[model samples]
Target: MNPLRILLLCHSFNSLSQRLFAELRAHGHTLSVELDIADSVTEEAVALFRPDLVLAPFLKRRIPPTVWQRVTCLVVHPGPPGDQGPSALDWAVWRGEPHWGVTVLQANGDFDAGPVWAHASFDMRPATKGSLYRREVTQAAWRATLAAVQRFAGGERSAPALPDDAPLVRWQPLLRQSERAIHWATESTTSVLAKLRSGDGQPGVLDTLWGQACYLGDAHPASAAAMAEFSDAEPGAMLAVREGALLRCTVDGGVWIGQARRADPPDTHPTQRSFKQVAAELFATEAAGLPQRPVPLQRSPDEWGELRYTEHGPEGARVGCLGFDFYNGAMSTARCERLRAALLQVRERPTKVLLLLGGEGFFSNGIDLNSIEAAAHRPGDSAADASWRNIQAMNDVALAVLQTTDRLTVSVLRGNAGAGGAFLALAADQVWAHGSVVLNPHYKNMGNLYGSEYWTYLLPRRLGDAGAKALMTQRLPLLAAEALKIGLLDHNDEGSRQGFEERSLERALALASSYNQSGELAAKQARREQDEAHRPLALYREQELARMHRNFYGFDPSYHVARHHFVHKQPHAWTPRHLAVHRP
Candidate 1:
């Protein structure tokens, strides 16, 4: 089939849009993106690009009839056929539906009532609406959208008739906060969790923190041990604080609230109104009064914490697992320092191989933009200072990983990774990822950031100087298979998260027990020594930090401006030229 020119219309270039952009382009499609700023803007885009079809991967608004009538428009809905309206995933998650789907429909006069080009379904899991969308919803949407695009490329203009069971699915209205209210007196942990997660990463559950109106999110179930001491506390009482999350007692047990946003700020600071901050920071005074509950680094599996260490296999052939599950995978300066300490601690263990298992939804997206933006409002702190500190702390973490020469180390990515996090993974002896993973290895997208996780040295070593330069300039996402083919990843395992974990452990065990394990370790140390002799690691650090320091404190305010708009969720005025292929 001949390749077609496609225009992507989206509210923002979110995860789904980015994934689609990468995959469709890989399939030989000439694509351009136009942000859904206004009907006039979209129409102008269609007129200028004159694409054969317009694909709306993620949009919150209806397509302009003028454009749709002029050309074919495909809208990807996060719902099954016959299901309509916004908040489809919200209602599904809140209701605990066992199965859900994605439908690709042709645009028409009515919303979500268009011809069904394609549809796909998957079993749902207990997770936040954002998490579900990022994983299952994204995978299903990709498949269905690709199928629809294929059909269109084959000259199929008309959609097939709806299935016999299409009538079974019904439209669901927007999920309101009142319907998601938590009855602290009667609701169990499970129900409360459902309500909190349903609207997570968006309009969170409308609630209060110490009688202050706010939105609550990033919740985790409190461990049994944490709840045992709080049994006498009232259902709504604040129990303890750990790792920037507040433990609030539920009727049956307790739940950890990780983040919150003030519903009614003084209108003085937009950060308060725009982004969610770590709950402990939001309620610092109140949280200070609560008891501190610290758990061991090697806690039980059922326990909840950002950092955890576990060991397996016999003493001589032991394999250590160092896991850091930061919320949403944004590593603030504090988090990076904590992870650095944890890495150093794990290195002391008598293990032959170590696995760096990052968080579930994201390995890391680099420094926390929200926190840096929030710093602008503080009295003595500035975003530049925070950026500098955070990047330095991240460098510390990377240095710790790079300096560990006694044992073999592998960076295992079970989810998406971007920016410095992608390079940080390169600090390991080997990098492995699940097939579903997407990696945005370059940092230029974040306001042309000159990234500083020693990427200057790390990337060139992996891809050579010319290849590294090409990749950095590309500014695109890389799928796991493509990454491996390009030598960015050493292994690409295909499976669910659970299956990936099991398979990775098996591989790590094999490496730990291999007869040539000692030889491999010695070879790795020798190579590191050779590289250091050619150019000291400190020299690389100095050069990278020099550029990064300018990014943080330099005269150009692009980085700060971009970060502010990003953390505040500002609408895009126009699409980036790199993504707007039709431009120029």
Candidate 2:
């Protein structure tokens, strides 16, 4: 089939939109992205690109009928057939729907009621709306999208209409504050989680905390063991705090609130609507009084934790595994510092190898734009200051990895890694990834950011100068296998995240007991010494940070503007010509 000139319409170039853009491009379609800022802008895009089809992967507003009627447009809805509205995923999670899906519908007169092109459904996991969207919804949307696109490319004119006996595709309004109100006195742990997870990453669950009204984010059930100690407190009373989250009692059990958004930060301007911050940091005065309960190394993975340490291998040959599961793998200044401290602590252990395991969904996306944006709103803070501090702290972590002359460092990527995160992994002696893992090993996409993370020094060494330059300029996602072929990865295997992690540990243990361990360590030390003698690691760091310092403090505001646009979810005014292949 001939390639179609596909125009992507989205509110913002988010994860799903990016993935769709890349995949459709790879599948031989010419894609040009236009944010749904206004109908006028979209129409202008349509006139210029003259697209054969328009696909809306993520949009907040309706496609203007004028454009939809002129050209074929398909909306990717996060709902099964007969479901309508913007809060489809939110309603599904809140109502505890067992199954969810993605639908490809033609853009007609009605919203989400157009003829069905294709759809893919899956069993819903007990997860937040954000988590569900990233994993299952994204996968389903891609499958359904690809299928529908194939049909359209094959000259199909019309799609199947809704069956007469089909269930009513009732419209769901935006999930509001009232719909998310938490009733601690009457609600159980499950109910509280449903409410919180329903809106985990967006508007958040409207609730009262610290004698003020705010929105609550990520939550997990408190361990029954911990609840035994705080069982006597009032149902809604804040109990304990740990790992940047706060615990609050429910009638039968309890939940931990990881982050919060409030409209009343004294430091922020009154005109500013609200501020979202780590739950612990937002209410520091109240948090200081809460008891601290840290999760031990052997604890279960059921709650919010930024850092965790575990060990594999027997007796004399141990391999340490360190995991940092920061939200969306976006490390803020404090989080980077915390990770640095953990890395410093773990390196002292008597291990032959160390594994850096990032979060389950994302290995890392780099700096925490959300935190930086919030910090910039404070009385004395600036985005540049936050950016500088965050990059420095992240550099410290990478520096520790670079200076590790004793044990071998390995990065086991179980999920996607992008920008600085991808380069951070290159600091390791070996980088391994699971099959489904995707990597975006470039920073230019983020407003020409000259990324630090010792990436300038590490990436070139792994991929060579020309290859590195090409990779950075291409701005595409590389699967694990493709990355391994390009020498960006040491090993790539197909398996579940859990299985891959298990295999990585086993491999590490085996390497720990290998006959070449001593020789390998000596060779590694010699190579490091030679490289240092040639230029010095300090020099590399200084040179890289010098560039990054410019990215932060220099007159150019590109990096700052890009970060602000990202955090604020600002719509695009025009698509980047690089990705707009159909552009003249």
Candidate 3:
């Protein structure tokens, strides 16, 4: 097949766009990206690129009719053939649909009424819109998009019509606060969670906190302990706090609100944390007054919790699983420290083998940009200080994993991993991932961050000097299979998440049982000693931090500027030149 000149149009070069960019490029497609900040700019980009076809992977605004009429433009909608509108996933989640799909259609004047090119569906799980979009929606969209693109590449002019059984196609408007509003006085825990999660990462539920209106987000159903403790509280009353989340009573159960922000509050001070912040951090007085409902030692899927420790496999050859499921996988400075403590605790256990099971939807996306941005608004706070501390805390966790010499360690990624989180997994003796998982292992995107977490020592060791250089400069998402082929991943569980978990534990146990435990430990210690003798880990960390210090405190404010825009959700000014191949 001939390579097609394709232009990628999106509201922002988000996760979906990045994934598409990497995949299409790998398949020999000439691609360019342009942010749809305005219709005029988009038209100019279209004229400049003169693409054979324009693919709208994710777009908020309508494509200019002038271009869409002249060139075949495919819009990737998050919902099925009949599904139309901006809040496709949000509505499906709110309505509790059992199945959902992605549809690619040629752009028409009426939004989503265009002829369907191709579509793919997936079974739905109860999850935040963010989670669904990243997992099932992404995969389905890729398949449908590939089909549509192939058809275009094959000189096909027409597409198939929507099936008769397609759901009632109608106009669906953007979800507003009223649509997501929660009636705490009457809502159940499940209902409350659905509403919050339907819009988790954006436009949080409008609710009141401490007499001030705030947007509540990242809701989790209260734990068993909290349920028992607040067994009879008022439905709307806040029972207590676990971690940074606020446990508020529901009709039959309670839900935990992890973060909140003021809704269009006056922007008076530069340091007022008006953005989304940890509930406890935002309401310190209220949180301090209530007792902490700490996470339980036992693992229970019923209750919502972040970190859990469990032992798997036979009694004689047990493998300890230390799981940390941070919301959206953004480890704040405190989360890194807490996870470090948990890792240290797991090391003391008598289990012979260990696995670091990160979250289900996302293993990690590196430091929490939102939290660090909030620090910029803190009284006497600076983003530089926050970045320094957060990266160091992440380093503390990585160092703990690197320094471990007793038990054999492994990292099992069930979902996507990026930046320092990807390297943190590499700190383990072995790294394994499910076939569906995607990884972005470089830090240059975050304002050329000279990442810590011993990535300097780890990545090069896995991919060599030239490969490491390519990885940093390319900044493309790699599938688990690709990562394994490049020596970044040690094992691949080419199956379901459940299947991967079961088999990964079995493999870890087998490795522990087959290998000489004493010899493994000794060899590990010897290798560490050898590496230290040549180039100490401290030297690597110091050199990395020296570069990072300049990034934080130097004359350039690119890091801070990028972070500010990210947290604020500012529209993109321009597409990156690397992805926008049309640009010089």
Candidate 4:
């Protein structure tokens, strides 16, 4: 092919544009680079080059019509053909789009409203905005531009003409701090999870805890029952450490428990309880407050207790606020069993609504892993199986809560929600959290697998499969407000316990009273539909798992190594990527 003259126009001489310029020049073409897209500069550059093709690889500003008309100017947009403009990668990642592409189009007066010349598409991975643009789009642009130049030189320009009725150009504005605020009450674990993953390894999901700007990272979605089983403190309180894990609370009365940083100095206050400890205490207290009733266990009837409920007239009954102390709780299997039994009793109630308002400063922090370890280490005959059974029991309990239909449960949270605590909130029909609350699912940081069953179904239902995988596998967290935007919570309001309780109860009652008791039926129908849709995929997954286990079960040193690394290492020692690899 004959050497062709090319004019390379860029908004700035940034790294990306510079690389493109180098590539073009290396191709033995007569190339001139213009660092500005200003009308006069672009016109002058186009005139001087008199090139066969004018290419723009990374120009942010608009190019004048004079310059485009003067030469065969082509713009390379870093997104799919339809998804043009700034923040393209951000939107793509946020939406969890399957594919991303680079679009080479004829430059026109209107920005990104050009006729398509050539396009290259690729699958989008769980990538950050910077990574997607830097790696995928940048490379695609390089390859596409080179090919386009060759085609133009050969007079094979098969550029598709822009239709008059094409969709209007769309743009996403830069993310603002205010827009990133976490709204606890109405935000769901899935919604918050997406936001956290969207902001992974960056400044992270933004939030103001007690009016202090806090950048959150390393979050994931877990089951409320799992969180409850793992934590032993009030929702916001720092409970005791089991092995190396630390537990906290979610907006709802669930547990948020995970590993604590070894680098950070330990709190000297003996009164401090880890999230698991506090959650166990709250669970016990709530269970004890319940009205005694005969409930059937596996094969026998046991006198189970129900949470305190008060009638609200035709509106429905309101469960009394469950008090929780962020600082005190006993961690034991018996406690977990009791808490589970109590919650089950509450679920069995014939009432239409149940509002679980945690104490002034906290909610349930989840279960006690220390107690779990202690039980496992006991000279028992089957410690491993027993431990696994405990986890299964927790999963079953969480699933029960998720499947509950008789009561429209509302978890009104006021503090930190971590791990299973966050999942507990997920099980509820509605969840509310104060602005001061912080929600985290730090499961990977803990040594155990993310055993919560609710996540398997709830996450995919709320945020799609890709989003759910990213959130759970990546271990990210979401602030309250961001949670709201993503549809995690039903309603959110910033205020005191009484104020939040009043609002949450009103909303829950409205929902419970208005709709006929068809939620359970509807849920079953939805489950059936999803099951039908995913049957093939589920079978494939099961097959894959079986094959993986067969291949690596006994000899998988990687699993042990990962467990050791996570259990022994400090929180700040690893990045988000490292933590995600080990998350169950």
Best by lDDT: 1
lDDT tens string, model 3, 1-584? 67999999998877788778777877789888888878887788888999999999998789988889989999999999887888998888888889989999999898888899999999988888888888889888888999998888888988966667777886678888898888878888788888988988876788898787899888877766558866678888877888798888888888888889876657655544367888888888777888787776455767776788998767657789988888778899999988998988888788888899999888888888888987876789988999999999988989999998787899999888999999999999999999778899988877878788888899899999999889888876787878999999999888765577888888888976774776887888899899999999999999999999999999988888877877777667787777676767
lDDT of 4 at 321: 35
lDDT of 3 at 576: 73
Candidate 2, residue 364: how far the Cα is off, in Å = 1.4
Q: Write the per-residue lDDT of candidate 4 for residues 60-148, one digit (tens) a residue.
A: 67777787776788888877676566656656766778887888888877667677877777778664454455446666777677767
Segments of candidate 1 deviating more than 4 angstroms? 265-272, 496-498
Error of 4 at 345 (Å): 2.1
Residues 1-584 of candidate 1: C-alpha lDDT, one tens digit per residue: 56999999999988888888778888999989999999998998998999999999899999989999999999999998889989899999888999999999999998888999999999999999989998999999999999999999999988888867676657788899899888887889999999999989989998888998888999889978889877798888888999899999888998999999888656656544557899998789899999989787898887889999999988799999988888788999989998998998889999999999988888888899988987888899999999999999999999999999999999999889999899989999999999878999999888889998889889999999999999999987788888999899999997765588889989999999999999999999999999999998889989988988888889988898899889888778888888887767
Candidate 1 differs from the real structure by a C-alpha RMSD in angstroms, to one decimal, of 1.6
Candidate 3 wrongly placed segments (more than 4 Å): 266-273, 515-521
Q: Candidate 1 or 2, higher lDDT?
A: 1
Candidate 4's error at 388, in angstroms?
Answer: 1.5
Rank ordering of all candidates by lDDT, starting from the highest: 1, 3, 2, 4
Q: Each candidate: RMSD to true structure?
A: 1.6, 3.0, 2.1, 19.1
Q: TM-score for model 2?
A: 0.91
Winner on TM-score (2 vs 4): 2
